[model samples]
Target: MIAVVTVLLAFPLGYLLRSHLAANVAYAIAYLWAFTFQTLYLTLSMLGGDDSAFSKNEFPISYGLVAAGIFGIGFGLVALGHRVGSRRTTRQAVS
Candidate 1:
C-alpha cells in the first residue's frame, strides 16, 4: 500500500534529518509537514474531477488523515533510531 511505502520512506529521512539538524523540534515539524501536503493533494486531486478513488459519500480529507498517521509511525521510528544512534556516538567519543 501507499501508506506503508510512505512510512518506510519517511523513517530514514526523519532519522537523517534529526541527526544532522541536532534539533528535535525541527525533525517533528519536517515530518508533520507531509500531512498538510497530503491533504491538499488528495483534496485537489478529487476536486479536479477525478472520481476514481472514492465513492460519492467518501471524502479525501479522511484518507489524508490516515496517510498522515502512517507517516507518524515512521517518524516515531526515526526518534528511536536517533536516540540509539546518538548513544552510540556518545559512547565512542567517551572511549
Candidate 2:
C-alpha cells in the first residue's frame, strides 16, 4: 500500500526530470529516492512498534513483490518519459 505510493510518485518525478537528465538516470534517481523513503518508512514503523504492516507468513513474499513492483514502475516511467520527450522532438523535427 505505502510502497505503491512511492512507485506512483516516481512516475511524475521521472517525467519532470526527463528534460534535464537521461530517462534512465531520471528513473533510477526516482527509484532510489523512493527506496530510501521506503527503508525509512519501514525502519520507523518497526521502531515505532507497529508490526501490523508485516504479515507472519507472507512477509517475505510481500516484500519481494513490492521491490519488484518498484523496479518495474521505474522502468515504465523511463519509457513514458522517453515517449513524451520523443514526441516533442519529433514535432520539432517535422516543423
Candidate 3:
C-alpha cells in the first residue's frame, strides 16, 4: 500500500524535476539514502519489539519491495532527464 504510493508519487516528481541534472542526481541520491535509513529503522523496530510468526517472515520482503520502488524512481528520473535534454537540444537546433 504505502510502497505503491511512494513509487507512483516519486516517479512523476522525479520526471518533472529532471531538467536540472545536478539537482535531479542529488535528489535521487538523497532518496536512496533516506530509504536506506528507513530500512534500518524498520529492521531495528522489528528486532527490538516484535512478536508472532508473521512479523519475522514479512519484514524483509516488504523492505526489499520498497527499495525496488526507490530504484525505479531513480531510473525513471534519469530517463526523463535524458528525454527532456534531448528534446530541448533539438528545439534549439531548429530555431
- Once superposed on the true structure, which residue ranges of model 3 sit more than 4 Å away at CA? 1-28, 50-54, 57-59
What tens digits encode model 3's per-residue C-alpha lDDT throughout 1-95? 33443455444554455355654565566666677776666667778875431276555565577567767766675567557766767788999
Pairs of colliding residues, candidate 3 = none
lDDT of each: 0.60, 0.64, 0.60
lDDT of 1 by residue, 1-82 (tens): 5454445554465445535444345545555575566556655777787666554566557666766677667567667767
Give the Cα error of residue 17 in candidate 2, in Å.
6.4
Worst 10 residues of 2 by lDDT: 1-10
Best by lDDT: 2
RMSD of each: 4.2, 3.7, 4.8
Give one digit per residue, the lDDT tens place, for model 2 in 13-94.
Answer: 5455545356566557666776678767866886677776664344456776878776876677657766776677789899
lDDT of 2: 0.64
